[model samples]
Target: MIPGRDFPGKTALVLLTSLAVVISPALAFAHTGESGLVLLLPTDYYLLGGTLAVLASFCLIFLWPAARLERLCAASLPIGSLRVPSQTAISAIACLFLTALILSGLFGSRDPRSNPLPVTIWSVWWGSFVFVQAACGDLWYYLNPSIAPSRLVRSLLRRPAALLRYPGWLGHWPAILSFGFFSWLELVDLAPDDPTRLARFVLLYLGVTIAGMVLFGEDIWLARGDPFSFFLRLLAHLSPIDPRPMPADPARRRLFLVLPGSRLFHLPALTLSGTLFVLMTLSSVSFDGLSRTFRWLSLAGINPLEFPGRSAVLAFNTTGLFGVWLVVAAAYLGVIALGQLINPTWRLVRAAGLLVISIVPIALAYHFAHYLTILLMELQYVVQIYGDPLDRGWNPLGLQPNFVTASFLNDYHAVSIIWNLQAGAVVLGHLVAVAVAHVLNARLGGTGWRAVVAQVPLAILMVLYTLFGLWLLAAPNIG
Candidate 1:
């Protein structure tokens, strides 16, 4: 595997497909009664149960043999050659689809909920698509609009190799910046769901992505820079399927039905930039959830009941976003430091990079937890728009026109199931993280007391994150 090969997102998921909750600030309150209804549930019990489950996973790993855990991480069910569609054709179609959406945003409905652009981008793409892509494999690889089109442009221009090499030092900062900006657009910038502004943002993202690809070579630029692609690529590591374990030679790439996260072991160690980008994945989502809480709104001197729009608290959320990111990063690095302090044998960078893979499950969990509701609710609108994308009330698909149903959100038993699933995803993610960490420890920390001692700090952090994640979901907010 090449050092700088592979990427961040087919994102911008990032569930940019949390590009899942890529829940518009406008639609934030769209599901108010449903989320607030969660306040009445026994979420505290769920939280406790989640914490205990994570702790239990940690304890079990501590007792289990290191080699046994390593074998589990290494486990996989071999699958045959993966036949995929023509990359250029599929990606070009994706590009054309994106262009149509951009045009829709420019000429579509004034109401964000009514606009197909925001609904498609946030609801279908970010909300639901990210979840499946992350779980399966790098589905975005075949669909990144930049790759094939830019290659075509490069062919036309008669330039084969890129004009310059993508500086390795720049690392994933571009992707990180992109995810951060995308997060802000979703969280801070008022009127993000507004069709016109969304169109501009998508256009800008496309322009930059295409230009970057044209300038830096499609594969190299996206692998090194483009945010959504960079974000999604990394998230794909947690997927249960391994479609292209060997990217250099496509014919040699055999698919495998592997245990989820078994792919992480194959991934090269993350650079500092790569590691930070991973942190941004979780931090950006964390701040998204945090910024919505009543406590956060009150901190910004806004009333939960008479909440002013995102415009009012923009500055505060902006600060809070970075603030939460810093806190998360600092806490994460600090724990690694403490872990190394406990067991001085492991190099800090090696430990940080290797163990950081464990965080992916938690990041995915957060995306799944926070965004599933939006996906569930907004998807109906997505279906509704397909029946009339131009708002001409055209029923081309013969589906229900403006036939979005909210009866389920209003149904108690239905909501109870959604709430449990959300909590369950969070708990399961942390449990997976614990198991992954144990696997990493088995490989790196030797065995017995020393290994357990070194990992104890991380185990505690996972426990805390499980609680924190559950609380964020259960917490009542202005939305």
Candidate 2:
């Protein structure tokens, strides 16, 4: 096995022990769904217990010296590598298929289940494919439909020159806007599930991406202009595999079996815009969970039983989404400032950038927990639709059963299993965040009692967030 260093046994023991304590039977239970399978909702006891578990972990981990953290954090095993194919060919085919998907959205069946576009976009792409991309690496680089055609044309003409220079001042601001807009479309759009509307939205994005690529350059445009690519790239840092080419062989890439969130340790301090982008990422997903809850409806003075569609709460949600982001950003910045106050040696911008990476584990964990059931329930439609994409009763694959229902929640034993999976995902995510914070703190040269004191502000912040996340999951969707 390709190996650089061994992971510290004490660190592993501490983490595993923390995980075990948090995941104990007394603290675990809750998964609300329409399937009549929820055993219990997260009560005050669960929340308090989870908070204590996380806080305790922070204290225990803080005692470990920076030198050991450097070793514990450094362990990586060498995994086998697979050679990638040419980007141009892959991108071209992906573009063609994406175009067909848009056409299908516009002309196919009006029913969401029968139509390929909405299911493909919402369930298959957003729910399923995104998670795969996060774990597997930035496959989107090869499959970026917008970037492909531009490269193909450039290659065909044998002219690989960019017409204009990308301004360094732009600093991914465009991508931030695009990402926010995309989030708005997904969470706040009224007709997101409607096929024709979904198709139009896809088509509009396609045109915008193509126009930007043509005017700027494909590489530069995609890096700054494409929100989805930027999103994927950020999440791709969490994957076990590193997509960067080997230094010795520029054309060949090697896969490393590093711990998740390891790459973030290597990232330099983020620009102001990039830091905002990270905040937006966390807040958007958090709001998505919050907006569906009864508490949110009550706060908005709406009856959960008689809840209106997205149209009625359009302004409220739009405003609330931004407000949620602002609150998170303020809290993060404030906590980092407080931490720096405890230890004046760390630079503010550098501290902000490093500490922000701690949020990656929590954000990703929430995303997985929030969308796990949605993916499981909706992906069946994705599978069934392939047989008759146009809803014309043409089974090209001659599949046996026309449709399948998710029975995982229906069965009592299976419900327990799925609930445990969700709870475990969340608890483990928080624990990992705590561990990452310890490592990051060490990276900032924090050690001993001073280091422990320095971590208090952010550590408390993480606990509060943990409480918020658990509450969101357990909160009934009366709205």
Could you tell me which 10 consecutive residues in candidate 1 have the lowest summed lDDT? 22-31
lDDT of 2: 0.74
lDDT of 2 by residue, 254-290 (tens): 7778877667667666666777787888889889878
Q: Which stretches of candidate 2 lie over 4 Å from their true place?
A: 1-15, 25-42, 153-159, 242-250, 394-406, 445-448
Q: What is candidate 1's CA lDDT for residue 212? A: 85
Question: Per-candidate TM vs. native?
Answer: 0.86, 0.90
Clashes of each: 25, 0
